[model samples]
Target: MFQSDFLRKFRILLVLVRRDYALQYAGSALGLTWMFLQNLSLVLIYTIVFYFLGIRTQGEDPLAYFAYVLSGLLFWVPLQEYLIRGTGILTDNRQLIKRSPLGPEIFLWIPFIQFLLHWAITAVPILAFLLWAGKLGGIGLPISFLCVFCTGLFVACLQSYLARINIILRDISPLVRLMTQFLFWGLPILYESKGILGKLNLLNPLFYPLETFRSFLLSGYESKAAFTDFLPFLILFLAIFFLSRARLNQIVLDHL
Candidate 1:
């Protein structure tokens, strides 16, 4: 019974994913090209600033520094977009949720899959640049890539859970934006994690995943230390997933 239900919902998720992709760029002058344009502009601006400020990594080469920052930006951008958009998935689609036969969980998956598609599209240029610039060393590509995937999944599930609660209390929506802004600085996206890990920086879970990603991609070195750091995040994600699933129906019904 559960398997049939899961498949039905998964099919609905795929349909919603298609709908979101179309709606996002439908009728725009530039269409889907805007995705690339936006990312390119942001990359150029950040690259220039970091270059002028002599923000190169300590042990990694200059090209590697660019690759590091770019990779993190790639993942971070999608994660942020998903969180922001997913926060309103239920509220914005309240009518559909109330009237359609589609499960609420399907609506929750739509933004995540849409953001994942965007992430994949954005990664093409980044990977090409890394290869051309010879910044990618084979040290921890697989592990780092896995970590990136995990981060995306973890963020998606976390956002879905948060969105449900946010609907119950509208105040959480703004609070989420505020928290994400603070976290952007707290994470070691532009700087080395070693410089700020010992103090209050430990409070942000984003730090470890960002650092682990950069360590493997930019430095071409794999320290067991990096993987060790992600253990806590893994546990936290699992706990949240189970707890959220347990109350999933109740939350949806209450909001409706």
Candidate 2:
């Protein structure tokens, strides 16, 4: 039933994913080169800005700050893109949804596939830097690599539900932006969660997964809290998805 309902459109979905991915960089001379440079600029900007302030990532290590920021981006960038793009999937593709027989859920998956592609491409430099620094092996590469996509999938599912809800409440778009701004500062992406941020980290859903990636990839810090603390949120989203999915599909196309 699940396959029939969702996976039936797999081929069409892949075509859409490919089209969108290509269109994303369309008209740009450098194309994906610009994307790599953008990622590198982010690392360089943070590294230089923080150096002046004497902000040590975990210790006196030099590349620790770069690795810390890069690992956090591995999760946050994809999740943020999912949140912002997925929220508007229905509205953005209203005409396409109107014409296609596929469910609105398929539209949600497009940005996800895009996220995965972007992450994999952008990560090449970070991986090379880590390999050069000899911190690559300490990262639990295979497991952490798996976690990255799984995290993308988990966030995608949750955001798909949000995409539907945003259709009903148009104000949700701005609210999501505001909330993510709060979350961006709240999550220890550019900095470690210490003192106030550490205590308040429990309130932000993105914290655990972001921290889990950072812990393994950057600091060799391992904790079961990623599972224990983060599982409930995932389960809650799955529950919401299951409960509302059918109704959403039935109304979404017509409403859009």
In every candidate, how many clashes are there?
0, 0
| C-alpha lDDT score of every prediction, in listed order | 0.72, 0.71
lDDT digits (tens) for residues 152-226 of candidate 2: 877766787788887777648887788778978878777767787787886777777776666567545554245
Task: Predict model 2's lDDT versus the native.
Answer: 0.71
- Model 1 lDDT per residue over 1-256, tens place: 9999888778878987777666778899997789788977877787776644546656566666676678778768877777788888788777778898765777888887777677777767776777777776566456656767777777876887787887777537787888788877776567655654544456677766766676666545443234456578778877887788797768666777
lDDT of 1: 0.72
Q: Please list the residue runs of candidate 2 whose C-alpha ends up more than 4 Å from where it truly belongs after superposition.
A: 1-8, 22-26, 31-33, 51-59, 224-226
How close to the true structure is residue 185 of candidate 2, measured as C-alpha lDDT? 83
TM-score of each predicted structure versus truth: 0.82, 0.84
Worst 10 residues of 1 by lDDT: 218-227
